[model samples]
Target chain A: MTKKIKETSNSETVVKTEEGKTLDQTVSALSSDAALFNREITQFNVEAETKKQRTATIVKNIFVYTFLTLCAIAAFLPFYWMIISSFKTEAEYRESIPTFFPRTFQWKNYSVVLSQTGAGASFGRILLNTLVVGLLSTTLGLIVIIITAYALARINFKGKNFLFALMLATMMIPGEMYTITNYITVSKWQWNDTFTILIVPFLVSVYYIYLLRNNFMQIPNSLYQAAKVDGLSDMGYLIKVMIPLTAPTLVSISLLKFIGTWNSYIWPRLVNIPDWRMISNWVTSGFTDSAGILGGSTSEALNTLKMAAVCMVSLPLFLLFIFCRKYIMHGVSKSGTKG
Target chain B: MPDKKDTLPQNDVNDVAGVEENVSNDAPQQPQAVKPSLAQKTKQAFADLGKKIKGVFVKDQVALIRDAGNTVITAEMLAGPQLSRKEKFSRFLHSQSGWLFVLPAVLLMCIFTFYPIINAFVGSFKQNYQATTGRFDGFGFENFVRVLKGDTGTGGATFLQCLVNTLVFTLVSVPLSTLIALLISVALNSIKPLQKAYQTVLFLPYLTNSLAMGAVFATFFTIIGTKSNPETPGLVNLALQAFGIAPIDWMGIGSPTWELGAISIPWAKYIVVIVYEVWSGLPFKILILFSALQSVNKQYYDAAKIDGASRSTILWKITAPMISPMISYLLITGIMGGMKQYSAIVGLFGEQMGIDYDMGTMVGYIYRYIEDGYTGYAFAGSLMLFAIIMVITAISNRISKKRVTY
Candidate 1:
């Protein structure tokens, strides 16, 4: 290493001394000689680096791939177990060395959940209700929040600071603080056992508004100004320019809102009566199993059925995640970047 | 209750239906042309002046006065219109657009949210039961007093412990989960093709309803089988058995503390609650960190590489500093989120779990007391929890904001 360093230093000094004679003759002579030496050194370095990088890259790849695969498996294990267990017979589940994979798939669990025995809560109706509530709430929430966020972000107004601060302050207060009063208001309005109870009460989200406002604020002022010069109305600018530009953030927030409304358990639980049930009622409120579909209380079939029910509820969202992983990741990352 | 009755829209169903009473009778004869005379107008103005004078002096004159000469006015404009340029602008601003673009949001918010919040604040004061009953007695500071003392008397469990428990859990778990998420996000950020797949997989738990997650945890954690030749067969117990150790009787009726034949599961509820919480929360942090990581310019990494910096050095010296703002944001929000955790506990341990509900979480205890008809105590507990969260969050914000390198 010392010898190599000394040689390189000597060559550097020689090159520096030669720099004063930098006209064509010195360059021509040196170019011919230097090209050969440069090729030799470049080849040597490339060969060495290739060998080293290939080996290290292989090892690194192996390690990263294995670690990442393990994490992915760990993430999916519980869900996979839940799905697999859902199809197992009651006897297979209870055994000391319970089979990890079911010998025979019990397809009836899905049917059992779906069929309205007209006795207890039907999983089908619950699913339909979930869809209704999710879509409705998301739609309403998106409308209110998008307009409000745009107004706050683009429209310079009086009390803007106070309003913005108030919205942020709302986020600090626990949601439960509103629970009793919301319940009272709903009951007073005779909205219990109805879909409006779920949708209207949660019509706006302060966090989403805050996030979208931040996103909207990042759009260039020139875009809006140009739109205005073209005689586009405020609504037109929002629809034509702002919406398209903020689509990624909008999609991300909408996804969050949809998921939140879908996954909401407590308010629905408190207000929803028997007939007016949602899918959450199946897994949470009533377990959605009547008769012997779940194979008596202590049966392995029961655990399996519960797992199946969970899978049924979670599968759609999970599948959506799998397919649109890129979109979701892109959307999520962009949303946070602006923050 | 009487006010509630008054507010409820009454249906005048049959009394007016097809009853052909002349509408003009109720309208009354048009009063013959008696416009306000100047004398009457002067008398009225004098009376208004008198009322204004009284409003300045009388204690109960709030209704008589509109502004009390305290409207939002610019003080610099009081130079009898001989003001400077700045004062004119200031005065112009005072009267212009007080609630212009913000009016719609504030109005909707007031009707939809603020109204309900006011109701909650008012409800926090009085102790009432049976929804329609008007018979509530004000307890002054008694509710707050009881909350502080951890006294429920005839109500239920002490709420003070729950408040402490919530604070402790939030304090511990927020940082813990955030750190875990940060580590995972950083690791995952370096990968190429499988990055999207990994994020989706990890985020699965957060997508599911917390109630379902809690139920699954509760069922799995509950003790299984009978005492003699007892089979402790949950996942944890099975793992213990595989290790040739005795199985823990989780969720047994006895205290899992220092007593013989006792089930001795230390902070079982908190663990269960935290596990479900962390499982559901990791995705949120991962998304946050991943986005922050993406914002960092690749040029920085290239520069560090040119300087012969290692990966770990680059992470510490380059990535961390760049992402400190996001990290701080996460810390503040994470604390706030954890402090308000209610649905997870309620989902798992509410009446359905067949275990004594954990009244140890602030919201859990408040929820329990409310269900048991202790409104006053629940509100007081909620108020205390709110105060604690606010103080902690404020401190966290101050510290994190100050320390944030960005």
Candidate 2:
């Protein structure tokens, strides 16, 4: 405070205002040198305060950056550990003293895991199952959500509000409630080991439908009326105008749905179909150096092999993130902010 | 529709009675005006066929009805029209076109979602229910009783143990992670240097497979070999050794435990779970809270600064309250997601989830019965899980309702 007062006494520029008016002109017009001196003193104090704030801001920034750096490192440590461990030998991985970096990188670990597909159903087949299921379900789910959203948004119908409310209410219930019964339902239909089972049951995501419906509702009613007047059918208007307008939302919803399918574990694991399990289902199963293929005498649940598999699984998601980051982040932020 | 109307006049040249009727329809209303061209007359006549209101071109005043094509359409048609019961029925059916759009979603939800919920409620009550045969001896409280009493006749994870584990994991991890995320968000919000790079690194974990990440975390805490051959005590133990702490078996059988009547708290194991949860959960919470912080009105900060409020005071009084709603939202979702956690535990401790399912969560317990052929118990367990989630949601809703600033 004393230093501030001292600095207030020091600065005396009497800065010019945006109207091209200076304290010198204003006080000279008033014919009071004392008032000019007081105005300059006040200006000095303001500048001094800002100067103090600048130092404080720099200090605060240093603290913030340091905290952020530590947090970023903590956040990234697991991936680093996973990568380094994947390259380390199994023996080295299990050594009494842990190695920060691999003495020798093991590219063979991935080969061994990939080659030994007999135990956990080959990685290739699992990848195919995932891709097929993801694409089909994402496509089918988007269609269901879009049409449902369109009907609810633009079309006049009885019991529409009630239907929408019912869909929204389902989101409140824990997903586990449906899964146990879905198990029974699917089993009763004997729909095991098929892509249909994976794709069909999860086709209707009420949340995505709700999202798309809201997006659809954003289209002007005048536009619909105009389309009617212009001899364009409802379907034509929807295809040419509504879908294109909501393309960003649709893209995000599709990406999220595909990612959901890629990350789904419980249902696939529950079905217990080795031939048709999704990518996440393959994560928990022990990957070993079987057939003595990696020059190992014994087959054990190798951490290195599991790490290699984890890397393979994670790489595609990273690629997806890099490519579709804008859409993904937009979807997430919209959900957060809107809610 | 347009195509039909476009060529209707030329196609039906032989239908002179219909053409005369079309001309006679507008002749009365437009006696003072010259007749419109034939195509315009046909188009007007076609448009006004189903809609029997005033005909077009009365002294060149009536708007030319262009291509309505025998449908009951007009600008004021939205004001509604008086109709016969059959027309009303047709209109109702026309209105029901929206149902076509919602049909697939409704069907899938009924079969997969709604029916299952009802089935889950009903199936839980059927005593000795056989899913295949659809038979039950009686329907009472038998399944619920068995689940609560831990008397499923299977020797896996008991209900009480799983519940305790779940509560401990969720209650500990969710808040811990939320705090860490808050701190990270605030820091990230403040700094302008390398902000995007820092953000990318922080958000890297968000898209990761939790199970895979869980395995990597497990490797950190895992003791690989026993004393005889003495492999690594893992990276975590190595870190602790630098601090003069002895090695501990984190996920192994010798892991420390505090037991009470079939419920045990393995602190070391809990720490590992909590650590992993905090790490994986941070990205999302950071994403949410950081955005919330960014969107806060800057004027409030300026006001507080002018009032000579300290930095921490500004943070607590202005920024925190501004973002409180988002924080509460994060807590509610974080806790909900934490309770349903299954895959991460599986990744960390393998399929059995730590020596015959001791670390089983609520969802894990449901799966235990589902996989073990105790369908009734699984249903009961799932219902109980549902009830718990509902209660938590209600409580969270009430709390957030009181505290939400905007």
Candidate 3:
């Protein structure tokens, strides 16, 4: 019987057909591999449709759509208000009767905020500072994360498990616990007003290391061995094989890191002077008509210019969201770690 | 042989004995078809016993010496109970690349993460600690006392008050937003035509700069006109005016308050905070819960339908429990994130957190102390915040266990 089974190639449950191996288990409406995503996810009331049941489903559908529409509006309202207010004049912004649409559009607010060359309020200089810090930190941090994750994933060494556990344990402690001491340490080194303070301290993020390690692990070890057999060194295998394979995860990490640096407020605010602080820091300073580009008391804080500043800060992230929604959402929902 | 001799006649003994010897010899070499006599079997057992006895009493040199013909394995090749220090070090170097790979991360973490953790604990205990000078008066719990008592000399919002605000906000908003997210995700899951559109729109807030969003939200409810000289009371009040209710000072200094003993609740101001929290926090929870809802097996719904269960019954009894683990995960993380909330308050109410810093959260309190050069108090406050997170996490875990049915 065993010999006959082996000869027939029927010992395994999966049947080899012309198409491919036939599935052993029964496939439900969405249980098939291809259908999991493309098919609608609703597990509806699939009972035989009587007129009453049909009407019930229709009513339920209506309620669901209305609720969703209302939620979407609530979710989109702030963004709309921010954009519209950015175009409004300062006097119009504070109008007791707010205008949904700007009475007169203005590109003047953006130009006014951009022209300020004051100490902390220098828009061009701060943007340059943010870009420099975001780039350097992301690149340096990526290298550190990659190497650490690769070693943890593929390399066999003494104390590897212990080292990983220790790293993960740090995540349990809130960052605020140790950040106060870091302030003293940085200040003691007199690293204030420099980019080193911003880039170096936050370079080693344990969460990213853990995430990349998991991603690296998903690429099978046989590939690593195959690379080695092909006369590739370990570093070469990592660069040519592991890195390419985990490109999606790397893109997600890089994007998040950049967004993190862009939106970072606390560390940059604490350790560096405002002149060297990040983009979010620049936005927090009340954007007034200090230039008097709009008709107002020059020193008075204007919501229009503030909105314009916020618009400028938020645009890049918005663009990133549109282009890379899949990668971003996957990264977020998988780990739920933001920066 | 002696038994045979006794049993057989003297004349026939030699021939019978020869035949018996041949049969025994044949039996020893042959298969189980030829059975062994008892005497022959006894002799073979004695031989094996001798070998076993010899093995116990004396050193078996054969174990040390490997077999030359077949695969060679010796006892000496095995690891002993103890390893030499030199051997350990050499083995460490054998995996040198692995060590080198993690070296940068371990070094930076040692410097910035691990060392600072130790220093915060030390600094928190030191009395009259000065940051610039790196000096301390002595070691005591005075910093903890002053921090808890609101006597750190820099005053606006006390640590206790901040703790209360954080708890109320977290307890109220996290669950409220979670329920709202659950409802939205369920609704989103059951839709077909506008699924992608609704999903894209709802997820727009996920990438928002909270600071910018906060300013926009602040405009929505911020009565632009002064209380004395009344004008249009923002969009929210405008809607309320349609219902014939008067506008209130929601975010201004003149905002109404009801003092419950030491702790005060600014209901109107809180409404703004809670509203923003729900709005800003919805996308992430929806993303998480929606994905979870998608993967829930249709079998459960089918089973519930066969049982004649109502829609709400299936939701509460079947669907909710199916994703209870994800819900609990969301809860723990949401509460923890809420405790560390500083920037959202800063965005809504400026760096001072509110007018006179009345809206300070726990992290805001810690940063305030840190900014004021009261490093000791900052350390103590941060430690307290850490402890609170640990305790709350434990409680949430306990609550989570009750929800995890299977």
Candidate 4:
């Protein structure tokens, strides 16, 4: 079954390229009287077949659309619930029968969350901390990755292939394996609860390096050779030629890395206490802390506040995904297929 | 092409001549190039110190000294004369100076990833490792033995239970999610319009923060009202109740009745995790398979139509095998990712899993050890996980080699 699929898919590409060459032959043969008569008969058969196929298609479409619409709702409902629940007041949220929509919009909940402080930092402060961590880590990581990828891709060096293979092998190891020792190392270095602890350890991502390296490899090596022949230094060539050539990929890597840092929870939870927690850490920890000035210390009150915080935290990422949907999808698809 | 290459070679020759002339012109300003600089002297001192430290471990001082001498000889050749084999070798090394570009990243990886991995392996053998003094009482296989025996000498579920949880989670979720994603992708591909809108909506879960969304999921499954009345059930329960089914405590904290072997399988928690995993994992898998399906030739379907093949036959025979590689890719990655599950569960059920480590995964189990200062056992657990991942990856790789085609 699989082999047949491969052949059919492969033959499709072949047919496209062969179509132009075979067009004249088919047209000329169709012009003959006997061929025309045979073609007319086949055309009638084709019309009938197409009509039958059309009904089948309509039936299929109905089923497909119904299934897809149901799945889409299942996908979208949670997010819709989150947004709507964020606007629900504590009393409404705690009602015996849950309301699909808020009885009355509670704009004050957002302001209350913003005003509340936990882990020695306000919500806005945690957001800023997250932004700073994301920006710094991504920027530093890109700089390191770009240079490494350029060297691996374009430059001839001793043991370059071996180094690349070694890096690829590291990717196979579960990242949890490194967490224990890294925590110890960071603690030994007295880097706990600091941005340095968050940003530094994760600055070198072999996956991003591999992705950018593949992109750099796609650029013609002749360009590097030409630049060298023109007396351009290696660094000069990398910055002038390669970087600009792979800007879209670099942007994709940066944006994805930024989102990764923003969404990071476990590492921040491990190393940073409440004082230095990122926005994600705050969303999980801050709402449950009784010291926060948001509302009364009840599960019902906290649920509303928690939903509001979740909506606030997720809003920026949602907007970013909406705006840069193409790049994000392209990056993921490129990595998935290439791997 | 010949004429263009000929002109280009001439230009290259002129450029080389220009470079040579410039080097010769600048040669007078650097007359003492053969002499080592202060930086070179410091670097050599550091290398000598490194050799001394390494001698304690390596016992091959002669080879180390010989390598050091060879480096000095190469440096001298680069600075002094350009007529011998040494000079040629030195030029080769100079041309391969791109190592300098990758040096920073390599150094960071060595310290943060490679060194820690080795340290973890070493530390796993150490008993009662003292973090403050950076010492251990002794080294043995005791930690690994304890981990395997599910006897951490602590009052909790054994490491075996955690391993089972992880394996069961991965085993169930990976294939289920991949199958759903494949079906969804196929259905989405068959449609003509609103495909993008459907894709955008379906991909929403992927963009969500797992921890936050997990909290939202916890809310979705929260059953309100007393046990008898069950008046205000969560959304999921409400939907189930519409069909006359009773509400379930989805996090499994309230009451778990299902049992598998010695452990009670918290079906509610398992279901919630699997649902979340499938929903979140769908976007990437669907994206991959959909693209693969779209790229399949329409002529195949037409051919099948002429042969009077049913839609199911066409889909199964012609579509599934074509996207087998993508399916395999998602499966392997999904399993690997599922085994490493941690924060999402924590987000759903908090730090303690189901009344005290009942739902603890392998990673969560390791984390609990870490929190309790059982660093040795934690490292041991990590090594076991590493081994499992390697074996699974190898087996899957071999299977894919035979099963998946370009």
RMSD of each: 16.7, 8.4, 14.7, 14.3
Q: C-alpha displacement of B107 in model 1, angstroms?
A: 4.5
For A217-247, candidate 4 gives per-residue lDDT tens digits of 8988788889999999888998999999999
lDDT of 4 by residue, B313-353 (tens): 98888888878887888888777778888877777776676
Which lDDT values do the candidates have, in the order given? 0.64, 0.80, 0.80, 0.76
Q: iRMS of candidate 4, one decimal? A: 2.3
Predicted structure 2, TM vs. truth? 0.83
Off by over 4 Å in 4: A1-55, A286-301, A336-339, B1-93
Standalone chain B TM-score for every prediction: 0.66, 0.79, 0.79, 0.76
Error of 4 at A165 (Å): 2.1
Inter-residue clash pairs, candidate 3:
none
Docking band of candidate 2: medium
**Model 2: residues with Cα > 4 Å off, grouped in runs:** A1-59, A334-339, B1-84, B227-229
Q: Which pairs in model 1 have colliding backbones?
A: A90-A301, A126-A279, B256-B263, B256-B264
Question: TM-score, chain A, per candidate?
Answer: 0.75, 0.83, 0.82, 0.80
lDDT of 2 at A268: 86
* lDDT (10s digit) by residue, model 3, range B311-378: 88988998788888988999889998888887888888888888767898999888888888888999
* Candidate 1 chain A minimal-lDDT segment of 10 residues: A330-339
Query: Per-prediction fnat values?
Result: 0.33, 0.86, 0.72, 0.72
**Comparing 2 and 4 on lDDT, the stronger one:** 2
The digit string of per-residue lDDT tens for model 2 on B53-75 reads 33333222222332335443332
